[model samples]
Target: MPKKDQGLGPSAETPLPGDDTVVCGVVRHLGGDYLLAKCMDGVDRKVRIPGKLRKRVWINEGDIILVGLWDFSPDKGEVVYKYGRNEINKLIEKGFLSKEFINALSEYL
Candidate 1:
């Protein structure tokens, strides 16, 4: 049988917001359905798992995730995506994240 396509091709990356408002964060704590994430920008944001992804995705503390900052609430955001091991390595290679940050996450796991 032919393999079924899983949607993402070469350009599976979700289009980034032009303003650079989205940033990487580490999940610090889980508050039931919400999360307290410490962003790379040095601020802790209350990150919410949107309804669409809530049931499908399972996030845990210390996992690396992408967050889209809220315009009205500077210290709050939505959890956009979670980075897998390979994706994390690629981000580090691309200079999107620092080696120190990756080291930090590893220590927690």
Candidate 2:
């Protein structure tokens, strides 16, 4: 058996903001399973990490995440996806993110 070669690029598909309900955000603060995320829409929302992803995903402050907004609460949302460094670069190249935002986010990284 031969070992598979893994490249430095993103291995899986990088999910984009699919619709109006999904938005891109930056994790600002982490408190247990909930975190304060600054959304691109200019709203600061309290986002929760669902039980399914709680143990599987290790979310941290300063990470770029996809948030699914709640219909009942405008200020609340749930973490749908987290972007890696390579994925973030791909997003920037695709014109989904601005360089200024990446520059600001670099402070946290």
Candidate 2 deviant stretches above 4 angstroms: 1-11, 21-27, 105-109
Per-candidate alpha-carbon RMSD to the true structure: 4.3, 5.4
Q: Which residue runs does candidate 1 get wrong by more than 4 Å?
A: 1-11, 14-20, 105-109
Name the TM-score of candidate 1. Answer: 0.75
How accurate locally is residue 97 in candidate 1, as Cα lDDT from 0 to 100? 71
Give lDDT tens digits, candidate 2, residues 18-106. 65455455556566788877777778789998986787677777788888888889889998778888887888888777777656665
| lDDT tens digits by residue: candidate 1, 22-47 | 55556566666788876677786788
Error of 1 at 6 (Å): 11
lDDT of each: 0.70, 0.74
Lowest-sum lDDT 10-residue window in model 1: 8-17
Clashing pairs in 1: none
- Candidate 2: deviation at residue 77, Å? 0.5
